[model samples]
Target: MLDTTKYEETTISTTPACQEDPTGVNYRGNLSRTIQDQTCQAWTSQDPYQHTKTPANYPNAGLDNNYCRNLDMRFTAWCFTTNPGTRWDFCAVGYLDPKCQATPACQEDPTGVNYRGNLSQTINNHTCQAWTSQDPHEHANTPADFPNAGLDENYCRNPNIENTAWCYTTDPETRWEYCAVGYLDPRCQATPACQEDPTGVHYRGLLSRTIGDHTCQAWTSQDPNQHTKTPANYPNAGLDNNYCRNPDGVNTAWCYTTNPETRWEYCAVGYLDPRCQGSVV
Candidate 1:
C-alpha cells in the first residue's frame, strides 16, 4: 500500500517543458494535462485510474505531483486521465524541432566507414587527440586530407575502412582505441524495431530484477548462490552485470536471485516495444 499522505504534501504550479529528445522518453516535464485538455490523475492514486506505475516502484522516473512521465521507458510521456471514462492518453507536449536536435548515433557500426557521430572518447575513457594536432600519436587522417570522412575536431571518425569507430586517444601508451558508441535513437531501443524478445536469449536490455521483486545477484558473484552462468562461462551471452538474461535457452530472461533459498527466477522483462500493451502473461 502507498502512503497517500505524500500526495497531499506535493504541489505543481508551473507548466511543463517541451520534450527535448526525438522520442519523449527523456521528457522529465510536469505536464499534468492530456491532449484532450483533461487533468491527469496522481500516479499514487488509483481511484479513477488504476495503474501499476507508481513513484514507490519507479523512484527515478520523475513521477511527481501528477505530472506526466514515462516510468515504463516508453517512447513518450503519458499519464492516467482523471476522467473515469478515459484510462490514459499522450500528453499534448511539444517536441524540439528535428533540425535543432543533433542526429542520434547508431549502436552498431561494423566498420568505421559510415560513422559521423561526435564521440570524443575511447573505450578506456580516454579523451581523443585532435586530428589537426601532431602530438604523441600522429597520423595522416585529417580534415584537410580526407574532407569527406567527417573528421572534425577530436571527435571519433572513420577516415579509412577501419574495423570499427576508433580515435587517436590522448594516452601516449594507448595511441588509438575503438569506441562503443551506443544508440541514442529511441526507435532502436528494442530488436525488430522495438518489438518483444522472442526467445529472451538475445535480450540485452538493463532489467536487473526478478518477477517476484527480488534483486538479481551479480553474474560474477557466488555469495548467496553459486551459479555457473557467468561471462567467463558464456562469453557470447553478454553477462557482465546482474541484468536479466537467458544463457541456457529458457522460456524467458531470468537471473540468479539474491535470495539464498531461491536460486533463480524469471524476470518480468515484457515486450520490448515501448507502445506494447501486453505483459509476460
Candidate 2:
C-alpha cells in the first residue's frame, strides 16, 4: 500500500571527509612549517662568518680611499691607519684605497737639469744603464758575436730573460757543459799488467801488478822444496824453519813450514832443495 505512492526524491550533494587527498591543500600548511624548522636548525649549526671593517664604520680608521679622492696627491696626502706588512706602504691621501691616487707629477732634479723624473739622484744614476738592442759584444770584439758580452752565458739562458744568446756549453769535460759522451777516466787499461816481481822470484802468472806493491819477488814452481830459515841466510837449517812447496802445480810456490815469518817466502827458480834457503841450488 505505501509503495504505490512512492515519489521521486532529490538529494543535496556535499563534500566527503574520507575522500579528501592528504597530499593536496589539506597538508600544505604542515609541510611548510617542517621545512622552516629544518632551515633554522641548519643555519644555527653553521660556522660564524667574519666581516671586514670598512672606513665608514670607524671614523679614526686611518686614511684610505673612503676618506679622500686622491691618496697619493701631495695636497691630499694621508697615512695608513693599519700596518699591512713590512713590504707594503699603506698610506692614503685624499682617498681610502690606492686606486684613486693620481700619478706623481714629474719634478725637476736639483742636481742635474737633464733629469725630470721623481727619482732621486742616486736612483737615477744607478738605473741609467737601460737595455739596448745593439750587440753587447760590439765593444769587446769577442770571437762570437754575443750580445751583452759581459753577462754570464747562464744568465742569458735563464727563462726570465728574452732575446738572450745560447749560452749553454757543449763540452763534457766542462763542469756545466753538455756533451754527446760524458768524460771518463781515459787512463784505465782494459788489460791487466804483469804481476811478476822485478826479481822474478814470485811469479803469479798474468796477475794484476796494481793489486799489491811491485817490490815483492815472483816465485816459480822450478824451486818447489826451498823453505825460509829465521837465521837470515841459512837454508831450512834453523829451528824457525819454513819451506816453499807447490801444491797447485802452478809455477808459484807457497810456504809449508809452521813458522809464520818464513811460511810463504818466495825463492829463486833453481832453489828447490830444503837446504837451499839463500843459494839457488
Candidate 3:
C-alpha cells in the first residue's frame, strides 16, 4: 500500500513568510505554496513575543536615573533604602554632593588677606584722629606738654596762681625755702615742740630751795654757842639780833646783859628782833 502521509522535508518552509500577506513567498522559497501561505497567516494572527520582551531604544540610558529626577542618584538611593522622602531634592544634593552656591568659596578682606575679625589700630592703620579706638585717651585733645601736676605740696598750701602762694615749683631751692623756719617761726600753724631750742633756760632744771631771809646759810664759826656777826652782805637782811636759846628746851631761858654789845638776844619764832630779856620775870 502506498503511504499518502509520508514525511517529506520539502513540504515544510524554513524561511518565515511575511506576516502581512498570506500568499507571500517565504524568503527561502523552498516550501509548498500552501504551507507558505498558512505559515504567513498564522504568523500574522499571533502577537510577537520578541517585540514585547526586548527593551526600547532609549536616548539617555548611560546617564544616571536621577539625573532628570532633580535629586542626586546616590542620595536618592540612600533615601529609598532608608525609607526617607524622595521629594527632598535639595537636601539630597546637600547630603551627597554639596554645591558651593549657598556657601561662599572664600572669606577674606578686600586685600585678599584672611580676615582676623578684630579692629586694632596698630594693625589696621587707624589713627587717633580718624577713629577714637586708636586714641590712648579716648579722643581727648590733651596737649603734648600737658603738665601732670601730681601731688604738689605747695599747691596743697596755696591753690591759686593769682594768690602768688602756690608751691608747685620743682626747684629744690624753692622747696627748701618754703619749708624752712616752719618749726621756729611761730607763724607756722603746725610746728612741733621738739623742734624748739633744746638747751635754752626756758627748759632749765626745777627750783629746789625756798627763797627768804630764813634760807640756810653757812657761818665761819663751828660752835652753835659762839656769837657770830651776820654776814655784812646778806642776801635779804633784817634786824641783826642773836640769842642763845635751847631749841630742844632742855635748859631755862638765859639773858646775859654783861655788855650791851656782848648781850645775847634770842630771836622770836619767825621774827628777827635785837632785844633779849629773861622770860619777862
Best by TM-score: 1
**Residue-by-residue lDDT tens digits, candidate 1, 1-281:** 99866565542211122222323555666678865566899998997967688888888877767987756533246788889875775564422222322332444444656766555655434668988887978899888999988877887777876656678988796688765443423322433322446547777865665654466898989879997988999999979988888888877788998888889987644332222332322
lDDT of 3 by residue, 1-281 (tens): 86645434333222112111111211122221120011111111122211111112323222122121111111111111111221111111111121212222122112212212111111111111221122222322122222342221121111112221112223322221111111211112122122231111122111111111111122223233344333354322221222222222222222222233433322112111101111111
Better of 1 and 2 by lDDT: 1
Q: After superposition, how far is residue 149 of candidate 2 from its true place, in Å?
A: 47
lDDT of 1 at 110: 49
What TM-score does candidate 3 reach? 0.10
Best by lDDT: 1
Answer with 2 or 3, whichever has the higher TM-score. Answer: 2
Runs in model 2 lying further than 4 Å from the true structure: 1-228, 234-250, 257-281
Candidate 2 has a TM-score of 0.11
TM-score of each prediction: 0.38, 0.11, 0.10
Which pairs clash in model 3?
A: 154-167, 242-265, 243-265, 243-266
Please give, for residues 91-186, the per-residue lDDT of candidate 2 as tens digits: 221111122212211112111222111211010011111112222222222224434343322221212222211223222221121111101010
- List lDDT for all candidates, in order: 0.63, 0.22, 0.20
Worst 10 residues of 3 by lDDT: 270-279
